[model samples]
Target: MADVPTHLALGVEYDGSRFHGWQSQPDHRSVQQTLEDALGRIAAAPVRVAASGRTDAGVHATGQVVSFTSAAERPDDAWLRGGNSLLPAGVAVRWVARVDPSFHARFSATARRYLYVIQEQPQRPALAGNYVTWSRQRLDDEAMHRAAQVLVGEQDFSSFRGAGCQARTPMRCIHQILVRRFESLVVIDVTANAFLLHMVRNIAGVLLDVGAAQRPAEWVGEVLARRDRKAASKTAPAGGLYLVEVHYGDCFQPPPPMAPLPLSGIRDLW
Candidate 1:
């Protein structure tokens, strides 16, 4: 009789500035390739992994979840410590566990959360240049916050999706969106069932325009109604984007959320 494969889940954190993306690509560095290679080494055989989401090139992640089936008999900590020993500095296996065979990393996820950080300053950021998108112009956080609220709930997001997105439907549900500023940094937090290619960046680009007074807050609603990608602002730079978390059912537990300082502001973005 053949041995049944053991299903395992892992949480990963990576600095994506150097990788091509999350998916494996020929002749290019990828988070998947780096991780799978490490896992294969630990298992002493080829192992494949499926992630909760495939993040784009130059986009970072702190709460990425991945799952794989393995025949190797190893304890959970072995997957974590052993994998980290082989991975490069850009990526790390944060945690590992054996999950029920029914738990799939991607499909089982309830929602995904992302955060984009904009450094609103005159000169370019010297300390955190690789981690933030720099903007010289001042941004109105209140206006951006108000404009972002229109994105809540289920709707067609074709206007925000990038070209070559493979998702058959343009419709997606956004659970929450918060735009706030701390010191010189403006952070945009969004949660959704899933995301299309360039959706978050595109949304950020448009909100930046609104905050900069280049467009009216109401224009976002018009853009959404148009369903034309051309009507939206250019995609924001990838450096500022971070995949913050992926939500799962009671079968899995996620890590703690990032805690930032308090934000004070008026209600409307005008």
Candidate 2:
């Protein structure tokens, strides 16, 4: 055989409501499986791909990065078009790029970003329930923002980590975190070098308490200082979370994120 491997990267977006998650599982549908099946059909051979990160069930993604090596000899446009055409309605490949052979999706990423959108109305939404989390309690986005400032910089996030997390260390550096309101949506946007399992959702749960006046904003800081998972509020629902971007910092390139809640006038790169 005279086949040569071609390394390629792809930008993907998916609505995770009906999918088990980004990782493949037994007897369950996953974004990775769906992607591999589609790409395999295009390549006329089975293809295994690696993603920037694995998202939990019901969690969405607008800027997921995937990498694979194939000898299919297809152009970038072919991979992109063929993938989208074969994928289910909830998943789509936004772009494809030929990359250096050494490039690996997860290992080469410099940072990752996520967004959690909440619907803070008195009634649960009937239309956007799968996309946004509904909260009947009155929320104070300003207070949540003020408290989130404590999370910036390198710190031990053990208090917010999931019980079953396999990360070797609890220390992670958060580049930025902001909680804000856009119309009916309360958005929590975060960027970090890496994250512990359930870190962002745990942070959101604590802030939700502050927003509801059930706890003072300063309590969030206390929770971090406690360094115990039970010290923080329960983890927020997976439906509200979005894996929005995986940054490479010039080492590689992937498409920019598509905001889950695109309420106009958002000047920031959230």
Candidate 3:
């Protein structure tokens, strides 16, 4: 008798510096392609993975959720420990569990969170290069936080949308946004129901201008009101961005994912 297919969910984390991005690409390596290959070896057949969100190039992830179905009869832990052994150093399967066939990684997600870490100093980070964004000027995180409040609630984000973004609409609901500092590091944390391509990065760019005193906090509202992309600041660097969490509805008992800490631990800043 044929083994019935088992629906599986995995919490995966990766150092985005190791791949082009999360999605598979024909010419460039990707986190999805690498993970699928390792898991395919364990399933003894081809495997396909769908992630909660498609992170961009150079963006790290600490709580990426993925779903796949396999007919293999290996123990559940095989997907975690066995796959890790076959995978390279930058990525790992953090957890594995059986899931209802109805659950879809992309569709089932209710909210997503991201953190953008900026190292503020005249000197560039040595060990933290490519994992944190570098800024020459010290920023006023308070001003940035105050300005960000305009973004809450369902609103049109056409000012931040990418030209090539294919989302059906320019509207999205931002659940929360916080800009704070830990010593020389300024972090921008955002949680939203969903995002358009480069949306968060554009928001960060505008906040950077506010923090640097180039623009007043009220300018954020003005930019949003304009509904034009050209009115916003340049898109922030992808390296500073990290997909830190994904939220599911009440029925799922999801594990708490770690924060998007920089290579230099946050405590080190103190």
Candidate 4:
């Protein structure tokens, strides 16, 4: 049999609230299932997809990447048009490009970036409903920024990992942890070599405590030094979290141009 290519990278985005998670479930909706279904339709053959990482239910992504392999070759446009034609409304393929047979999407990524938005207001805005989490209590944004600084650099983030995480190591190199407030919104941006499950949300939760004066700014540093999971606060709501970007090694090229599709009068597949 002829050799089949091993890598086909796709830049994707989705509103994860509607799915069980990224991986396919036997009876529940999932981002992987949706993408695989669309790919299968496009290729006229079954396709299995592997993503950079799984995002929990209700989480969202603006720059999630996935890859798979097939014996068939198709242009980037085919992946865009054919895949999008079969996918449901909330999921989209932003770009598609061919890659080396050995380029694994998950394993090749050097870092991942996440952003969490917090609306610090007495009442949530109707317009921003699905994009941010509303915290009615007043927050000290400066304090939050100070607390976030302690998280930069390498550390064992056992305190911020979710209980369900399966990663073998608790240590990760954090490139940046920035907390900025604009108007009534507080934005937390984190970039790391890798993250444990729910790491970003858990960090956000701990920062929330600092912002609300429930914990001192130094507490963040103390928690990291302790390497204990119980040192952190609750995980933040998934609705406010988004996988905003991913970085790879120098070998990868920029993705192909994306053709704009009309927003209206479009029918979607199940």
**lDDT per residue as tens, model 4, 161-262:** 898889999989999988877667677878999999889999999999999999999999998887878878888888888886777869675453221121
lDDT of 1 at 206: 98
Candidate 1 vs candidate 3: which has greater TM-score? 3
lDDT of 3 by residue, 221-258 (tens): 99999999999999998989988788888746568777
Model 1 over residues 1-270: C-alpha lDDT tens digits?
Answer: 776788999989888887999999999999999999999999999999999999999998888999999999888878989899899998998888788898989999999999888888899978677788889988999999999999999999999999999999999999999998877879899999999999999999999999999999999999999999999999999989888788896978766543211112522311
Candidate 2: misplaced stretches above 4 Å? 261-270
Cα RMSD of predicted structure 1: 3.9
Instruction: Quote model 1's TM-score.
Output: 0.94
RMSD of each: 3.9, 1.5, 2.1, 5.7
Ranking by lDDT: 3, 2, 1, 4
Q: Which ten residues in a row have the lowest lDDT in candidate 1?
A: 261-270
TM-scores for the candidates: 0.94, 0.96, 0.96, 0.90
Q: Model 4 — which ten-residue stretch has the worst lDDT?
A: 261-270
- Name the best candidate (by lDDT): 3
Report clash pairs, candidate 4: none
Q: Give the TM-score comparing model 4 with the true structure, all chains together.
A: 0.90
- Candidate 4's displacement at residue 112, Å, is 0.3
